[model samples]
Target: MVASVPHDRVRRPEATACAAAAILAGFSLACGPAAAQQATSQVQLDEIVVEGAGGKGVAPAYAGGQVATGARLGVLGDTDTGKAPFSVTSYTEQFVRDRQARTASEALALDPSVRATQGTNAPFDSLYIRGFPFNEGTSGEFAFDGVYGVAPSFRVFSDYAERIEVLKGPSAAMTGVAPNGGIGGVVNVVPKRAGGDLTRYTVNYGSNARFGGQLDLARRFGANREWGVRFVTSLNDGRTAVDHQKEQAGVGALALDYQGERFRAWAYGVVQTDRFNAPSRPFFMAAGVPVPKAPDGRRNVTQPWEYSDVDDRGGLLRMEYDLTDRVTVFGSAGGSHTGVERYFASAPTVTSAFGTTSTAPQFYGLGVDRQTYEGGIRAKFETGFIRHAVTLQLSRYVEETSREFAAARGSYVSNLYNPVGVPAIAPLRIGSRPRLSDSTLTGLSAADVLSALDDRILLTVGLRRQTIKAHNYLSNVGTFASAYDKSATTPFAGLVVKPWEHVSFYGNYVEGLSRGDIAPATATNAGEILAPYVAKQIEAGVKLDVNGFGGSLAAFQITRPVGELSPARRFSESGEQRVRGLEFTTFGQVTPQLRLLGGATLLDGELTRAAAAANIGHTPIGVPRVQLNLGAEWDLPWIKGLTLNAAVIHTGKQFVDAANTQSLPDWTRLDLGLRYATDIAGRKTTFRANVVNATDAKYWAGAASFGTFTLGAPRTYLVSMSMDL
Candidate 1:
């Protein structure tokens, strides 16, 4: 029997000094703002291996140890990439530290199929995967530990993450409906767990005097080592690469678990806060204006007094029991809350070729609360010549949002190139935020994998019935404005055929779900709720693995529905957007001391149907035609435990408007790094250094599907050291 345990307990960290002091008390590390800015400093500890109902502990790394051999696939549990029909990749904790990634977006930049749509200094993070928006709407699309609503809402730090997994294409049948209706892919974060007795300390420094420190501790108790606990805390504060911008962040996380012969349980909690002065914002293009050249990457037009602050809290509990050798049951409950307060100019609109811009400053406050519950059963058995693996999952997700806003006294004008900063405006008073919207999603899914012929052939089938219910209320008064409830069923079918020991052919047909649209007041069917829209994808691929080298080539097509108004002024889901793409990825050790990781994606997107005839056949906004990334690492034969690496990222031109009248030019960036591993005073230690945008190219990084664009980050340096005790 499994033992009962209380859920996670999380608290907001105090100021930088207090929080650093508290976390550094028992450790032998230094504290304070300047501690990390020194010439030497030490980083995060590795997690202990503990398997839940998922069948195994963390997946093993490939030859180079930068990427994992497999990743979690929602209700399907942990799956090897070579055996799974879908395309997925998981970056290991080693990769995160080697790159010195401060956030999820930084670590994800290496993927050719994904692109960041916001600036590095933006208040929140947003991404586009496979030519579609992932986290662009009111609700986030990230999942923590195979469940939604348990990770930070706005941004995710890598301090407490064991691995970051990306599953390509729509996954409604595999993972359930995404809160934001994202059809591109799913990004999952695996939290760190206790592993081995360890105490580790890390310190880092970034360009412009940014300093940070982290502490990690883990211990296992009991005679059988069934009880484990791990805790991690970190803080970063100082000026940033951008002009007039200062950022501060603090994070604390705790994880506990109990591993028994037949029962297992895990609990996780995390709290984080981020503060920014003169945070960067996206840019918009005025209608009929020609796109202008990008300004210097360090340019900033916001007043120094403008600021933003965000706080996030999350907790999760999971338990599993094995009824028999062939059967297991599992359940999990988790929740997260995000709070935001900011006073700054919204997206600035460029009005002329000379870079003249206009924006209105405002004060905004927002709150989002999310909760998720899931339970599932897995069974494995054989009948005759076929071996079957079956699973059934039931899940529910709920989200609530509230907001308050007030505009400044007047608008401000600035030049993107010259960056004229105006005097700080008086603060706009905002009242208590009222209920804005609430949504509930419920789903039941089942899948079965049938294998025969010594596991050479595998066929999988699955289905999910998903229900979406949402309510919108007027701000302040909290009076109901509108409501909708709808349900739909999505299906999945996949096949994998292995002809040789190291080669496989795979294909899949899957469907995705999105909330239906509400007719506008001008439509004939005003206020009517349409049926939930369904997206379909057909994919086929080939995989190869031999002698520590591996790669995959895949081709797929996705078609999504869009709302449109007919000639009769009746609104309905009658339009469509279609995208066809090809992907090629390679990862592993090419030689004894050389490693390669990168790929390229080719996309062709078109608006198949539209409300306006003039828009037919136009390319979708923000869908680049070509994207490429190539990275390599070489271990110096002359020096032991030393490696050098370099990478290049390039994106093709993209349209900024649905009408195709505005566009942003293509851009390319280069990155370089080096690291050394050695023992310091009998303790294992590593030192790393990196240069981002090494050429200091000034360009437009990317465009949002909504027609906004982000400025590229300037050249910057990063360095860090980690030591284990």
Candidate 2:
């Protein structure tokens, strides 16, 4: 069950003079003539003729062209009103296009608090925000076009998006149950749809031997402008710098929209497929031995047969109706199906000096098939003194996983004891290897956003209830088994104050709960199941709109109880973890020709309690302390239709294990882009070139286990051309 808070009824006077002044300031910067004329008139100076200006102009005339837009920073729209509160950061489409970002990870690099790992493995390439790992297995909340889509594995293409939004902290009221909710934040991808023009087409190529294109076409009809259709498609193929690795992908989408006086409808569908080669898992060498490197000084250990493949399909339908002038009703439903298959080599053996070797049997095959369905509805209305918005959502998710492998049933193998001089022996073929697991999540939630105090202050609150059911079909015959059922309620709250038209201050609190399903140690009775895990968060931030310059700053804290896992007992509750951090970002146009955008973040994460004496008070895995991003674009007036841009990313050292026994070093990378746009045969065309890791810096991006590290990519270049018709 869920409840919504009542709206507050109050009124306040508007800021008349302040609004006028702000508008005037904006006009002066946007149009120089008006500002100059006002200045000259005040000075009582004679009318002065200006070049490129009409008679009686006071200021010199200059070519007026489109100004570059900067990134969007500040709070997120889906923030909870009362519980687990936090700030949000957004990057607009204009920023992404100006930077010419090639991937989602690259697009997020504009934020100072976000650290990205660009390893060869697709599953490992992820983002760490405010000391939280937000990636595939441990995904935070994610939304598509402002709608909640609760699937961990969502395939997105940068070419099809208009912008990306990063919401900091827990937001269970807006989002829902997830694997890890305490530490990380949510990222929402906003798609591009019909606007203005009726049709457009673009094609691009990369120097890495990859080519792709997209087509967007729209049509308008009817007297009331009630019908529209949009279509998009893309494809690409390329090889990575890693040894023997290749990647291929294809994507397509279609959308239809209908608009009437009181009713609106939207239908959309998408399909994506990817095939790629997998890289080797990293490992450490013995003490005093030289670290082995590939022919080019990079780590190389990938097996020739390792590979990964994925297929995804999804669709959505949404409808809205304006019941009256101040009342509206809206509903949305969506579904997705995903399939994955992978074959990878595993290095389960390690060497120690104390005459002991540790090893586990290597597995070569794993597969997963997942299906999800989500639906929601909401109504909004405004009264004499209060505005009210309410939302109700229901979701159902299901996932099935299968694993097959051959195991060794003998003593641990040692590097020196290999009589055949091979590091790993061939795995014997077993009669049959089978393992299967299934999980289902059902949830319901209701929320409201209220405007009170004469619209000067806003209040939002919500509650959510969820049930998780799990079953392990192969529990009686393998090392993995689980069966569990549980339920929990999450609450959220937030407050926003608009002291002035250009400034807003907000704070939030939110909570999240996830069911704990334990793995079986033996092929026997049902595995032990523990209570649901809960995470809490709090955050406060401020947003400033200074005419054309926008900026935001926020501070947050998150806490969660730790659950330990082992082969004997599965989970032992013993520790508490907390993450605290601050994030700041600035965007918008600094000048007409030169645009600058950047952000920075500082965070500290620690474990307050642990079973191991040395593990207590240590930093968690993959959390960095300091992250920074800086980007600038210059439009060269001397060279018509030419622009130059540069971006830099810096990340501090990070721990790789929960105990903080091992760590990855700090790293920095630079990227550059050049673009030229002109009219050819009466059509708009653009030529672009990009250089990533321009300095060819060799650095470690991530680590899987003790002493195992993944290297970043070397310098790479991409050249592309696009034409609009």
Candidate 3:
């Protein structure tokens, strides 16, 4: 059973303007019939030289070009952070359009160990890296390109990303099992391809009015152009800044490539949709209460006739072939489909401290489907003094989930600093969705790395062996109540050690694989299905890079396993959390017109086992202990192209239950931006203005690892122009 799709017939406005004009007419027929067949070929082309060189494509941008000098370490491809010993960052597509970042958690907000456990007008996109929980609830932890059930399963926009990588800790032997057990970090994405020729356009505005449009195109053909194409699309809609909200979105992406010389290929596709009317939910305190103060950020406890809808479709296919020149063979396959519908109202729970709240509006539905497959072999020989680089992988992933809900006959009472207006309640519709859960993962990995002397020593090792199957059924009838098949192996080791050509010194020890939790329904062994947990990490680092700036300093520790409910209430995995962290990072041009990007992490989490033993040493619920960012940009030796930027984000106090006595406080924010650039009528333009929370701090900004808490964003205001068509 899985029939449900009616949000007023998918919000007809002529079906979103005929689905954005049939996706801009299929992006002009994918580069207008390959440039009208190379302009009536007699074949005499030869001026396509497009080079911004960086091996295996998409990596070049370091040194003030806005991050990226290597990243994409899943199966270890495209790496090079001083020979990788982990802790990577990557970001570019010109830093997601100079930070106009519309998603992927706002392009990871300059990573201070990431955090965004929902909100930025939530409709899905949850995070919190280093201190755990990356995309929670029905998880689909990022990754796309480096594969993982193909992206877009709950929001990931940033128009056809060309970069966005982050790796930080446990990788399950370098990316394999993570269908829902994100061991602290890993983000990936990297799509856009087609270089040289292009067309661009943008137009945006935000804050209280919203409105947007964007399109980008790229092209290339044969006769050595080696075929390529790219397309991106976007559309936005009105009113926002909270209070009875409104938002709409759409996107279409396409990327294709082939730079063959020995076979190489890539293909991608995406389609997205989102709608909200009262979308935003995160707050659930009510037990011993206490944890309120955080109201006016354009407060709106929903009910503008509540609504929400989402749809996503995804695709990917990759290929490689060298077969010699030191062996290469590669493969990829992907799939994704997500669907959701909502009528809202289910996370309000404030209950006092002068805020008082409660909710009940439900009409939810959800569906997810995913698929992934990979194959690999990478070689690069030399055995004498060690040169290696070997790799060997095999992966498979699958998922399916479905749900439906209907509740809302009563229940209400609100006030988060004045939010009243309740009268529409006939919702509760969503018929049939059942199925709920099924997964299958498989793996087999191997790694090598090696390298010695002249390369200044490096080493890495790996192992995977995963395997996990799951099932859950019984939503009303579907049978099969709970099952799990497990296996695990995970392991890895690393070391770098340049020691001077600009410094480098790293270390690692990893392992991760999770999937084991299922008992809920207040557990008496409710649905059982456990067994398959393992997480462990250990890291150390230092990486510099001098002159044009770059930095890193890591320290890590992870340890996982947690599932609770005992005292004979039954449900197990015992419990344990441990996080321990210390990151620090910096990036590119610190002078030369000034440029720099954020960093700072320092976590400490802990709860070394607890089913309640007074919650062991506590400090786990939403673990915060400092996260920070810095960001900067400047470059206006008197306006030639002008520029200026800012950022300051911070977070600290957390804990919101699990006996830590309810908490959440420390906050800080600030952001600002500006841009200029010349030529207008003759094209080549650019204009921009930004101001996110530019001092409109209302606090409570994060926390969600189940303790719920998000709500912070209200100083909005954005503007954009962009040209070059």
Candidate 4:
């Protein structure tokens, strides 16, 4: 049973001993970032039929298949993307159905270090990667198959993903401590499994009158076929391009599997609901206005019966076994619950910029419940020439939240480039609902990865000890104003060198831990709570893969600690916020009919200390020293299956305050796409179309590192069709 007869017997990796995983990360355990049950409890079914055989665990696709040569580095189970030293990028599901992207930040906009800070009809899916800010409803920061209460604290809909990696820097010791820490990195999402024979259907459309449909099913039989099943569903309804915004969504996902020889299992389920009508607002300045002039991205000052609604459900189950062939044991658990209702119309305070504005009217009801768990143990050893793979993990996440909001006293003055709307005021309620917050995140990690010379020199080290508890209650005197518990220990290191097998060179050093920062109403000791901060990073990179393309270039630095205002103005936490950078990217096939993906970034952010010292060396507000992305795809060589694409996005200036005298300019956008495939009568078809912001530029889509401001995302149009049913 357990690894039936040594599970195809094989062993040749040995270098062992990582000091019992750095002394068991100092004890208190639970936390496994992207731990696929710690590599399926150490795999082994002849190492999954030797490398890849139906029990598929991600990775495959590189070279024009829309990215993915390697990903899932939390515990390094899918290594090789030039032997990795960090800086991942996955994205594939045929690149989100040929870039018809409906979420996951528009398929990560082909990452020039990611951006998507809640613009584009805004059903909310915030992001900013690499230069900070990550707000999926305030820091839950996505992740799903790789854990994190099954992603959906605010947005998660890319047809339930099938890959979306994006790792970058500061991985609390390689995926273990991120219960809202997000030291500027992390985004995993890999759901949708169940292989072979499948039936599908899809229909979609967009542009001011949305429409959608989707359903997919997959199957497999037993007796060696190993049993599997998959199901998916989706629906959307629409109206958007701002002005009167409207949206509706629904999703259902299910997956089941079993592959045995030494046992393998899987389970996943999800249900989602969504709604929005008129919601899309963020652009407040005031304090000394002057950052105006960004009005017409189909202007909509949100006031036609504002709305938002959401509901969610979840499930997960996982298993593994292989207590031989060099050990293996795995486990996983999951939970999820969410509900939110919002009535809005905030952000619109200008003060003066000739476009005068003002608005204040909000209401909200929120509820959240989350639970997660993970477990692991892995081993594979060798010594003489070095070779090892060891891991020990534990994880936990808990959450409970409840909220009620109010803010409808009176105020509505318009003119942010001529905008007016009134008649809606009813919010002065604030509190009386009870349970406001709660959180718990635990972790324990230990790792090792080595391979000497012949394997091309690779090394890795790990440690994690996270723990962060939080509380805040007082929704109406239920008491508990605050409570916090903290702990930290994050550490990691990595190195890789391949001299040339296609080129590779890497480096890493990481640390990250967060929780501690609550002082925002422009601070003045605003809500207090500070003392759980740690962030550090250092990176170096180079990668390339010749023939079929694929490239990378990196340089990094990160630092953290903040809480602003306090040259006596109190608010403390001693501030700090470095973040140097230099990144470059590239992707598959530069020939075979062209294909490419973007990259470019170069920042040097700052803010060393605050509270007036003239904002320390400035440059913090909303970070943007340059960002770019470029995409291309072509394959019209007499149209065998057709394909055409284009993408280009840019961001450069940003700063909306922090005393940086206001800024916010510099933007660009352009996107276009097409897809085609055929088979018709025998069924096996595909067709797609897209056009995003194609010259509908009215600028201003940057600055949301917390101080509002968004626009730029107007001209959009999409279409889709699929079949195999």
Best by lDDT: 1
Please give the clash total of every predicted structure, in order: 8, 14, 0, 14
In order, the Cα lDDT scores of the candidates are 0.86, 0.58, 0.81, 0.77
Error of 3 at 394 (Å): 18
Report the lDDT tens digits of candidate 3 across residue range 1-725. Answer: 01111111223433333322323343333333344443334233333222331113776677788888888889878887878998988888777787798987898887899888788897888887888888687767899878887788788898888788988777977898788888888888887767644678899988889899898887656545566777889999988888869889999988888877899888888888999888888889888879878987899888878889988888988888998889989988989888988887758788888988988887878888988888888988888988998889898988888888776777678898898887888875646788877888999998988988888888888888998988888763456777888898988898998968989998899988888888888887687778888889898988998898988889899889988898888989889899899899898897889988888998988989988798888888788898999989988897778899898998899987878998898998998998887777666787888889888889888888889888888898888988876
Candidate 4, 1-725: lDDT as tens digits: 11111111123222011111111222112334323243334433232222211136767678787877877877555676788788888888778888888778888986998787678676677777888877644555687877788778777888868788888777867776676677788888888776544567899888878898998776655534566777889898878767778888999988888977788989988898989887777778877767867877878777777788888888889898999988888889998888887777647677887877777767777878899988898888888889888989888888887777765667778775677878877666665566888888888888888888887888888888888888887764557777788777888888988887888899998887788877655666777778778889999988888889978899998988876666556677787889799999998888998888888989889998766777888888778998999999998988798988989888999897777888988888898888888878866688899889788888888777667878788888898888876
Candidate 3 residue 321 C-alpha distance from true site, Å: 9.3
Candidate 1, number of clashes:
8
What order do you get sorting by TM-score, best first? 1, 2, 3, 4
**Tens-digit per-residue lDDT, 509-551, candidate 1:** 9998989888988999988888888999999999989999999
The CA lDDT at 261 in model 1 is: 94
Over all chains combined, what TM-score does candidate 3 have?
Answer: 0.34
Q: How close is candidate 4 to the true structure, as a TM-score?
A: 0.32
Residue-level lDDT tens digits of model 2 in 227-344: 5555777777776555455677787776677767788887777777777764434444344433222123133444344456666676777677777765556666775555555454
Off by over 4 Å in 1: 1-56, 521-524, 564-570
Top-TM-score structure, candidate number = 1
Q: If both were scored by lDDT, which would come out higher, candidate 2 or candidate 3?
A: 3
Relative to the unseen true structure, what is the C-alpha lDDT of residue 554 in candidate 1, on a scale of 0 to 100?
A: 95
Clashes counted in candidate 2 amount to 14
